[model samples]
Target chain A: METFADSLDTPSVVVDLDLVRANIRRFQAYADANGFKVRPHIKTHKLPLIADMQIAAGAIGITCQKVSEAEAMVAGSSAITDVLITYNIVGAEKLARLAALARKVRLSVVADSADVVDGLSRTFAGEASPLRVLVECDTGANRCGVASPEDAAALARRIAVAPGLAFGGLMTYPPAGGEAAVQDFMSKAKALIEAEGLTVPVITSGGTPTMMHAAEAPVVTEYRPGTYVYNDRSLVMRGACGWDDCALTVLATVVSVPAANRAIIDAGSKALTSDLLGLTGYGHVLGRDDLAIDQLSEEHGRLVSTGPIGLKVGDRLRIVPNHACVVTNMVDEVYLIEAGQPAPRKVPVAARGRIR
Target chain B: METFADSLDTPSVVVDLDLVRANIRRFQAYADANGFKVRPHIKTHKLPLIADMQIAAGAIGITCQKVSEAEAMVAGSSAITDVLITYNIVGAEKLARLAALARKVRLSVVADSADVVDGLSRTFAGEASPLRVLVECDTGANRCGVASPEDAAALARRIAVAPGLAFGGLMTYPPAGGEAAVQDFMSKAKALIEAEGLTVPVITSGGTPTMMHAAEAPVVTEYRPGTYVYNDRSLVMRGACGWDDCALTVLATVVSVPAANRAIIDAGSKALTSDLLGLTGYGHVLGRDDLAIDQLSEEHGRLVSTGPIGLKVGDRLRIVPNHACVVTNMVDEVYLIEAGQPAPRKVPVAARGRIR
Candidate 1:
């Protein structure tokens, strides 16, 4: 029998459907047992099929980083009525797209600055359906969002007063291992918003590393964890998931055994990506912990052996990259490996390359 | 009048057609005067239109790293009869594809090990025409290829004797600033191959940083420079080309100005790529050398100001990424900016995800 693993091309992204389903069910069950609505971020897989699977597994909605990404998911699944775009949408083209997307789905966006909210207000004014806006709070992430809770409350007040824009609570993507700070910040911001006669309905806080502890934040009503659908080396290093839980991998072939203790694979920075995620090497070679992907060019991955590696040319190896989300975006299509199936199903990465 | 720059979507790969034509002509002229064949690598751009442009500008053939990439280019241009695949083609699927490609075009491949040549020989045996094989020599570049000159000659002899395989010559992707070493190695390998009653028809050696000094290596008959057509920040830092010579840039919009020194752009690692290429930042912000793209999430690029940056939300900035080739592979489509065209023409990246 020609198995799917044997027939597929080299340097391809393979997702184990069994593992993906298990991951989705595991996270959904955790959220259900607690009192949180799970809104999985589609940025990890960037596939409409995967997003649909997530929504079918009890997710309240989907979360996307870009307007085009949200549009892609919404177009794929009629069940995906609610979408939260976590990045600020700028420019006339993107704002118009956002407005159009809002007309189709229950769309809400996050903004930390007055300019972004003002732009959204102007674009959505005098529409039959008002646009929902959430104040993005920086709870120790320090990446994007308002720095202080007072700023978050002020932004909420601004959204409440802005025409054709309804204040839709607060959202925060806290730093890994900083769930307590997120709780403190969200509670303070909610209190301030309530004091200003604004109703805070949804308080979203999430990061894959701290997803299990999300219910500890009593004020958080929704959680958005993207990478839990397909764990990676970074997640494993953070003690978030076991090695067996890594569902996605880059199946690369050893193209050249140039010298002793050195081999080259077809997967390079273009496939494995250059996001170190604080790890030492590029990726983890499955079943060969002694081998290290020490260097990468655009199309060549250099694998250095820490110990004796008995790999030869044409040998295929599955590598768990440092970050799964970035790897998903690098490729156009991925194979879904179903258990006991002879051929894997190919899935198009629908929401990929949607940086706008 | 609306300019092409103003009409483009944020975080797009924009290529200046004039600069691309100038770059191709300049490199081809240099190689023509130096008595070398300019077989430009298509991995930099991966578009059939760009490959056709290179052939129109006097490129002898096209060089690709994967079989599918070569197939895409060959399918696009009938003029692209000769293609040099610089990576080892492994597995039954790829070998069959290689055989099919060989039947269509004058295909040649590089191999460093006996196993690869054996596989190719088995796959191409009994065909009407034999497949050409080149011994890949590692001349200071420790990535792939035989380590010693003797090994290169041995591989050449092996391919010469193998059924359905003809010994073409030698090929090497030398380390940057190692032109003398490549010359010495190729000369020694050529003498050994000749001593075995074999003809050294062609010797190819190239890398963008050392392309200008290619003529110093008298034994090299062909040069393959992938990044010369679209110079990037790395090429500029290495003094290979001036900043103005760069033909590609990622147009990004500032989406958030959260702090005094921090501004966030819509282009993140997905668009700009994490290829530092030994540089300090992810990319060079055009006209703003003081600002640094110090951090990158999947969808957010964090720009930190050395001093005060007067950038506001919705301001668009063109960033010259550290590595243009990787950035080209990241996006699905790129815009071609002509000097007189009001709007840049959109070109789909035909061979973007052809990793196999």
Candidate 2:
């Protein structure tokens, strides 16, 4: 069988356009059926074309992690008008950039404290439009968010009255299996914010693992799922997706087979990324599930099998990395495999490395 | 007590040129004393300016992992004329690119099998200059290279008689603390190749943890050390270098203080990378030894402490990541901290994502 790995150069990310569209539609259909607006996060593919596909498929808007990433997405695709940055925007430089980005798109950001809110207010206080700021709540993940529902309410009130800012809603990157906890925390926060006479327009939560049960959190108006567009090994292991649903795979060529059961591929941390996500191996080798990606240096990944490995130099393998989001950020561009196409189209990951 | 994080943007890699110069000189002095040439691997910093600095500091050449990276390094700096790609180059597109690169600079590559040797020969068969090919020996690293010294000599002979290939030498990415194994394998391989009447002018070995003992293998003529330019937590923990010798640090701003002992920083896997390198935490927070970077999301790092974490929102901290080489590849550019300069200079990592 002619595979994507056969034609492409080694150590390149190949996105099946067919799979991406199917994924976008599947999530959109689920959100539509469950009464939630889908704001596909560009953090997965980082390609404006993919963002355009999401928007065209009926996404409410897009989500980005950084101000520069938002700016790059906005610059690359005119279809993206609404952006919600789900991180606390800090620093005068980033706040200024956020203000500048607000002019191009309908920009909304999140904050859990007055320091982040004050910084955003300072930059946009004199702008033509008020910036929408969401109060991030800690349902359970504990990475970033307000401590309690009362704290979330307080921050919401603070954002509602802050100059050149409006209270958008509550957002949380909740635990994988904590939809009930998310609902409990967000409902209380929403009720309290409403009790204070503040309108919470949106309650957003996301994680591919808990996506199917997202309707359990009835208070959440929007769902921002990134990796669903390019489901990876972590999502697959979580039962969020299967091998057939993975849109992106790292195409790598075997470089050496020094032992009976051991071979090395050109893809490593630099190509596949080192995001283990609690898995034992780095990634799942497509069609070669018996082989374990035992070790990875910077530019080489070691594959070992229980038997003779059955591999040779120049043999290509498609790898579904443990996490798709970080792998997308490792390359400058990715190849898109399409149906009935002679060659895979090259698409630049426009927002790649926009971490600042 | 002004820190490197005080003056620059958050989530940026800051390199102290002074410390880099010291590291270069220290390693060069050791290599010079031991009668070996230093070939600095650009895989660590990926900056042409750093490559130039290494060349000026007495590096005989530069080591790159991919053909496109070598092309970018040569394009960005005129000083990098001698290039050695340590990874096996496969596929036609890359081979064509490599052949084109050899036309401009003195280029060499490594191979452990006849498939690779024949590919290199086919690419350079009619060129005016033959491509220098090295036989990679597996000195127990098990990542790549021929199985044994006999296999190394066999590949060396294959390259020596190839249409337009010159047998450069033997190369190995040896296991840490296995200098004696490297010495035994390389000496035997050298003797075997010499008995076959082929000139083996160079024998290269590298690994940051065993860098100090590289000369322990007296037959090794050149040492290719990548991480020595920017010693990281791994090196510091392994006794390869001290904390003061570290040149690169990730400057991050605390964005969320969700609990008394848990704080979150803006830098995550995207900025600092997820390379554990057998360590417990993601990185070593400068001057904050009590804190542990327990978890990393795509955009958030969770820092926890046994006691109440003193870090507040908007506070800056310098983090020495677990693996400096992978961390450097995460960002598009890094800020150079200079001694007398008023502001840190922004240097583009020209070869950051040239994985192919």
Candidate 3:
């Protein structure tokens, strides 16, 4: 008998719009009740359709990592007018692109150094509107931020006086489970900036692992969580969401059952991605947790079990990948099972390959 | 001061055409002297230009892991005719695509089960020409293959009698440093199939790690290597290629120097992939191995050192990623540094996101 999923090619990403809607509503409610604004990061889904859904569900804005992504998102959707790119963007070519993107959306960016500030000021010096620049704080994440709150204040002061730049506020991708650090660092930075006679408009903090505890950092005026809309095994392992809450899964087919304990699926690192994120296996096989996805080549996934891996050839399985963000970036089109739609609709990943 | 590399956006892949030509010429010469057919796998560069260079250097067609990759490679280049898809083309959608691809070129695929053969037979039962099918054998890779030589012979016989299928040969993605096993298993399988009055015309073995020792397995007729065109840190560590021979390098700009020991680059997992490949760092920073690419978020790569990290914001660095194949798939366009040209040329990654 023909099935609803037959239209989708195997090793393709399948995102349930119902789960996405529920996830967006749940997180939006949590953020609203907690007195924090939700700015869903489009890096996880990389789709303008879901960004529109998040906005429809009362999200304040969307977050993008690159100017190209912001351009693609704003061009693809009619609702996403605000975008915050949380990175220290350097170089002239990207700065011009950033200036062009700033003209389209209410743009804000993060910076941790004088070089990035000067570069931005150089590009946007003569623009009609000043660029909103945020001071990125460490907050114990140690990825891209200033070392201390003093450095954050210093950067904030630099941005406030830079040509064609306005000191927006503070931003940090805080360490997972480090709400106290976020509260401590951001509060200190806000105090320092206030003492400098500058008003910190919006303090932004991002990360899916600490979205629930975002209220702990009361100074954080906005919450940016990318992965909650399409939670994966990493988020589930951290108790951020349940298995049923996962919106994105790789739809694969069993092409080889070579042994009693081994079965091979058509999906591999190319489809599922190689982002382990401290997970033992590649993904959580939906209904087959007993089976471990042991290894992945570019085009083959090895599923092994202690006993008979009861899977046969042509059997289909859905894998919630290790990192949903990276998985979505691997494919061109994702199969969407939207609410009220009987069949899966294929949607192109609009912001894919916008790494620059 | 402005430089020639200024035209390139930060976190962009740069492929040196000079090095690619040299690498392809060197490998093709080695294969010629060893009397083995070099069917260069296009997964690493994913560019038809490089594929054309490989063919000009006397490669026997190209190797693609998916139907879409094959389609992109064939469509982009004018000099390609033969293609080999080293994967079990499963499901009706892909089978139909595979059938369509076969009509345009000399196409062949590998399978390890009767089910895969049946799927192909059902799709191409009444085609004008029978599809070429190779029995995938297990030479200790333990990923996707029939278990033993006897199983290989049985599958070969199954394909021999299947309608609209011709038993072409045998293929295996053997384990690294397992040339003896490839010789032992493939020889035994060939003898068994020949005893059954079936001709095993071509015996294919693939893997970049064991490409140099491919001739130890005298029964192998073709050697497929994907990573030789652009050697990465993994290949350099394995003594396969030197650092200077690496054709592809991620051109990134230092966005933050957070501390004396920490710096951050614009490239992250979205630019440089998270494929560790058992390496200590995400990539090898050109001329600065002292800095370890400690961590990667979506758009930030943290570089840490034990002592004073002299890097400043706005400084440019090129990284030879841990795995070049995965890195090429992360972006849509790459900067090409041709030999005669003074500046870099932008080229779209034509076969990127061809996972399906």
Candidate 4:
């Protein structure tokens, strides 16, 4: 029955702003200690306000996976100087958007094919400035990017000769390894590109799980790890961060006491999201390891207790989502809570649902 | 390699201006045929644009589960004259939003306890109009609402005399059963209120799954169903509607040809969403029941095939989501596709992610 005009109702996203600041500083310091440039991935926290804080705290640039996310971030923060678009810029419409962004800021994007390079070339042919391009090599992750060093070099050569494209460097997202595979992949890619008498300035490689390993990789100059700032359930399960390091949580209220051992919360898939990454359930209840959210309806979350849940009717609980990236796209706004505060400062999740 | 726009993305939330119109007409016709007033729930498609279409097709008003959704429906549609908020307005902040919305439109909400009624009374005590309230009697969903008829009547009496509140009538969301439990519960609640010399004029009950059988319930005078517009897998699996009657589908592209039998797609939880309602895998591949979306990453959908899937790289396919309501909140726009047309009109998902 408490009314804080800013305190959102049940099934709302709550962001810990103080924790986010600490996470940013920790990652930034880690990157500095290892002689790697921190291009903190903006895909984790799409809000421009948070991006401003990260950039101000000594992030070399920001990395965005979608053009819409990059567009939203730049529109909100004109102060951000460097932005590395870490996705393949395919299709004419997206290439045109990328070219326009090049005129606005120091923009760079990655591609793994010659056809994509040609598309970017034609789109930026008459633009005021050229778009920076990087050939994405597949060290592992196997989702996108070229397979071998030969393919990466071929793409780099195409970018060098394209009408309005400048070859920036080589980039690869290796799987979880102790820097050996990343260093080998980067060394081979750099050698192949330099064999064509082209200098690869920036070699980017990093994921949240292998950020520390990638930072220690001698061949990589820049790193792009997204979920490290807002550690999620997947990150905790992967031993990247502890539960206390997670900055984002879904606040839900117990709406139903179906049974003595079972209760349903108001937060469902619409709030907690349905991105379970091989995890047991949708999310983990904060401060309660004994309990698990068993099932989720569109508007109801069924939670089963191991012991006594220690929860009653109308009780509020914070849940760390399975994956924070997908959770960010499920709401319009999120409340920012300072450390050790019951009341949170209202902050608009400005780019919450920009999934284009 | 097709592109929509910066604002309008393809494979987005499409409000079939025509199908939505037809759906509204059909649901309203059903309500009229059954002698029930239609208060169409807007939670399924959280858009004021579609709410206006429902009103144009003779909806009594609109039903929203969130105050944020109600605010959007009121702001977007002038024809939505009355708004019944279906969820419990718990906190002070949401109560203020609900009371403020009451000033703009004919607002009604549900409550099951004196504490909630007292909260509403405290917010709008000196307002021009008393807050319209309905007792949410739990039929069988076991999510929220009062348990028994006596509990319903007690809350009704408290609201009838409560300051700045009016006892409207009784509302129960009967589960999947027809008249098994809901009919009896509502009848007893009506008798109790009538014995107290009070008229239970508005005995509303209905959900998408129970709407068909709801018409025959003698105690129910009105119906409120949301997902009837776009029936999902749950509805179809329940034998509610045929596959042809379902309106929504997610269009995705095969981005990776990893193996002969396995492939990856660009659309993942971030795109199609992973709201699997006890169904196997994430969603159903249209026209290919054998092909299952076995797993989903943040932006990668791992599709498993029985025999090569006969799908080539760069091929686009439509996927029927497990649940349509959660998918609506994950995008900003939707494409209204024709039966055989190459292009579709871009309809803005006006109220996407309006979760407060």
TM-score of each: 0.98, 0.98, 0.97, 0.86
Candidate 1's chain A scores what TM-score? Answer: 0.98
- Kindly report the TM-score of the first chain in candidate 4: 0.94
- The DockQ-based CAPRI class assigned to model 1 is high
Q: Which portions of model 1 miss their true places by more than 4 Å?
A: A1-3
Shift of residue B161 alpha carbon in model 1, Å? 1.6
> What is the lDDT, from 0 to 100, of the residue A336 in candidate 2?
87
The TM-score each candidate achieves on chain A is: 0.98, 0.98, 0.98, 0.94
Over B258-332, each residue of candidate 1 has an lDDT whose tens digit, in order, gives 888999999999898888888888899988988999989988999999677789998989999999998989888
Report the lDDT tens digits of candidate 2 across residue range A1-356: 14555678889898898999999999899999999999988999998999999999999899999998999999998899999999998898898888889898898999998988988888889999999999998888878889899999989988988999999999999988889999899889889988988889999998888788889889889999899998999989988889999999988899988889999999999988888888999999988889999898888999999998999989988899999988889988899888888788888889998887
In the range A155-231, model 1's lDDT, one tens digit per residue, is 99999999999999899999887888988999999999899888998999888987988888979999999999999
lDDT of 3 by residue, A1-356 (tens): 12446777788798988899999998899888989899989999999999999999999999998888888999999899999999888887888888998888899998988989998999999999999999888888777789898988999999999999999999988889888998899888889999989999999998898688888888889999999999999999988888999989998999899899999998988888888999898998998879999899888899999999999999999898989999988888888886678788889999987887
Across residues B40-86, which tens digit of lDDT does each residue of candidate 4 receive?
88877877767777777778898887788788778877888898887
Q: Worst 10-residue stretch by lDDT in candidate 1 chain A? A: A1-10
Candidate 1 displacement at residue B268 in angstroms: 0.4
Quote the chain B TM-score of every prediction.
Answer: 0.98, 0.98, 0.98, 0.93
Give the local distance difference test score of model 4: 0.77
